[model samples]
Target chain A: MTGWISEFMNHPATYLKIGWLQISVSNLLVILLMLATFALAVFLPFPKGHDDTQEPRT
Target chain B: MSEMWTAKLRTKWQKELPIEKLLPDDQPAYVASWIYVFGVLTLSALAMIIASGIVLAFEGPAWYHTSDAGKFTNSMHFWSVQLFFVFMVIHLWGKFWMAAWRGNRFRTWATGAVAFISSIATAFTGYLVQTNFDSQWISFEAKDGFNSMGVGAFFNVTNLGQMLLLHVAFLPLILGVLTVVHVLMVRKRGVVPPIDAEPALSNRGPQ
Candidate 1:
């Protein structure tokens, strides 16, 4: 099990470089994930609760 | 009518943050957005970090390096810290776009900003105390930056004992206090309404 897991995990890291700015592929993926999550949070409909129809408090 | 200090303090506390406000059963309708959930997600990650950190502290560095159980616990701590930062950054982004400081909530935003900085410092100390070649190299490299900034004399990142104490005790205390104050401020001020929501709700300050 450990051997298989280690084999899977041990891989050369890929980095993206744009001039002096460089970031690992892993880091870039995480950043993209964050952006996607933020977009989803904005657009996704929230689950309705008992008070879903309540008037907006002023 | 007593003028005792404790009584006066109690009255002031109640007046400032009554129980209903502190543990509100309901929030404004605009708060139903999924974006608002990231704050609680950040807090959950922080709780996981503290729990895993406590386990790591109990076992020490050598055990974590050599033993399976300790290594698992160490991984838990590492992953928790990662999640904490990820959730916290998302929360920060959400709050920033929302203009969370509106309606006299500048202190809320300020405390949260300070807490984020404190958390970074805490994570830096944690890295320094890792008792590995990575930590050694990082400290050696970081010292120059600290020295250039004129804070190396006090911070001393290379000193394991100082870094360990700072990570486990000092920074956590500061972060905890900031988090409590931030949450209380949120409760007191109420959630900031959406940008396009009612003008009156957006302008409503602390109660």
Candidate 2:
């Protein structure tokens, strides 16, 4: 188990290590892009009529 | 008894989704948003993924990595999956802030969420069954995560045959079923009105 751990820790796939957090470049890119996508989706403005409220229906 | 149940089911579905609404020619004006396109894009990509996956399955993993037809099908599957995730994430994010759960459409929203989760599982299994060094690394890496959550023993990412079966059959089955249910629910309960839009006559579901 220790040998496996040591080998994995040394693997090229383990691209990022900041203190304890470990992730590959591909994984980090996915995370970052998803965050950016969510932010864009939230910040984008709705079309005119869609943004306006009306009185409750009878 | 079966006849009675079938009749009831028929009535319920008809009530929930009348023929015209099920295949409407026009959507509400608010649906003009380009963001709305991602849902259909995601579905289209899913269809492509399944088509390519079927071809790959017919060829088997050895052929998939070696033969020209198999390689093309594999590439199609890969790209389709990439588009599926790209479009699905945008769709999910758009719907989240849109408060798509409004107007008693919680079930519709919930199904979408469940389908997203299932798709992730399907993709993970797909990665594991690739029979490549990437799969080896990922399975080894993912094992610790799953074990920490106490599910590694059951899931067994390193088991090639199990992962292959899961990728080709079980996980895809779950994802497909969940996606179908999610779409049917969306059709049954029309797109939620924008939070600020008037409770228009065109809005089909309960307020």
Candidate 3:
């Protein structure tokens, strides 16, 4: 029984294998993405952030 | 005095926490169309997702996969995710067309977009947690595509344990942290006003 438990815990990879569309969630990319986000926050400024003084466009 | 503590605790522990403890007075100064609802709605769904995710994580993967209560909770989490992404995408488009980046508020807009991207990644990791047929299929298919793209070696999509840890721990952690930062920034600066506000501010700041 213990052996079964060990195998199940260790060999979970044997059961689940995600394909390409799934890997689009690549963990590595997640890091690159985080960095890119920080970059955008600092640089390209897409979503207008908090600026209370600006009045609404007429 | 003793009664006050009990009442406070009860208020805090109720099934539905009074989430809107504070109200926003700083209006957008413009751009208050129906389209803006998508952004706030997405944030609401995100709140639901985080709450449901905590419940499922505490239950453990196998229980959620097999038990009746667990299954229901899992479904709730799953549906919440669907809701999050759907509203997020719509919110993104609405923000985009509004040209929300015009003023000093660009940072907020950019940060929001970044959070959206991170949220999508978090969702992808989430799908791998279920040890069901769908999870199995997604795993194998993802491995091939990712391997071809050259990221499979480092991140084996077929690894259920890894996926579980990532979905419940890593991705959620990042998302939570980012969310905190996003909220803080929004509170500090307030939402950007309408496009016309920009010119108005420019005309007044220096003169």
Candidate 4:
């Protein structure tokens, strides 16, 4: 199990290249995750508790 | 009687950042979005990084390389930094889309941008100071880049002691100060309202 885990973790990084652009799979995954997280943060409904109807505080 | 300089300074500070504004009990209703949470999440990760880093610093590199507990602490520090950057970048993206610089808050945006850049530098120095084969390779590769930019003379990546001092002290100090100023600006200016929201909804002053 430890060997398998180590092998998986230590595998050579996979890269995608197109024209002048090249990126590792791990980095691409992280970028995608950030985008998905941003989308979720935007679309998810905010829980209601605060009285939004109150006068706008200046 | 003329007012004392200390008293005058106090009054100025209070007028600029009143206690209520500095530590408001509640945020504006619009601040309920999940996006707003990333800034605090980044801060939490940074705190973890600092705490773990402090332990590693006290134990030194040899301890971390040899001892199980020190290795664990080092791993914690490394992972915490990863989380910090991830959260910080997301927070930056959120702020960009929301046009957070609106409502005369340009300083807030500028400070955050500078802090991000500083963090990159700090992380680079951290890589150089790892005192391992990876660090050796990175420093060698980076030296030419820095030299081409004409900064290698002043900022020597090959010098482990200089890089370690920069990673542990100078860069962190600048990053910390920038983070503090960024957060303070956020508190002082209040979170920017949505791009199309009512002008009255701007949380610029006392809330």
**Each candidate's fnat:** 0.68, 0.24, 0.04, 0.76
Candidate 1: segments with Cα more than 4 A from true spot: A1-12, A52-58
User: Which residue pairs of candidate 4 clash?
Assistant: none
Q: Give one digit per residue, the lDDT tens place, for model 4 in A1-58.
A: 2778788777789999999999999899999998899899988998887574588889
The worst-scoring run of ten residues by lDDT in candidate 1 chain B lies at B198-207
Task: Kindly give the stretch of ten consecutive residues in candidate 3 chain B with the minimal lDDT sum.
Answer: B13-22
lDDT-superior candidate, 1 or 2: 1
Candidate 2's error at A10, in angstroms? 18
- DockQ, candidate no. 4: 0.59
Tell me the deviation in Å of residue B117 in model 1.
0.4
Ranking by TM-score: 1, 4, 2, 3
Candidate 2 chain B worst ten-residue window by lDDT: B198-207
Clashing pairs in 1: none
> Residues B66-93, candidate 4, lDDT per residue (tens digit)?
8889889988999999999989999999
Q: Of 3 and 4, which scores higher on TM-score?
A: 4
Residue B188's lDDT in candidate 3? 46
Runs of candidate 2 with Cα error greater than 4 angstroms are A1-58, B1-3, B199-207
Q: What TM-score fits each model?
A: 0.93, 0.79, 0.63, 0.92
DockQ of each: 0.59, 0.17, 0.05, 0.59
Tell me the tens digit of each residue's lDDT in model 1 across A1-58: 3788778657877889999999998889999999999899999999987894577899
Q: Provide all candidates' interface root-mean-square deviations.
A: 1.9, 5.1, 9.5, 2.2
Q: Is the docking of candidate 4 incorrect, acceptable, medium or high quality?
A: medium
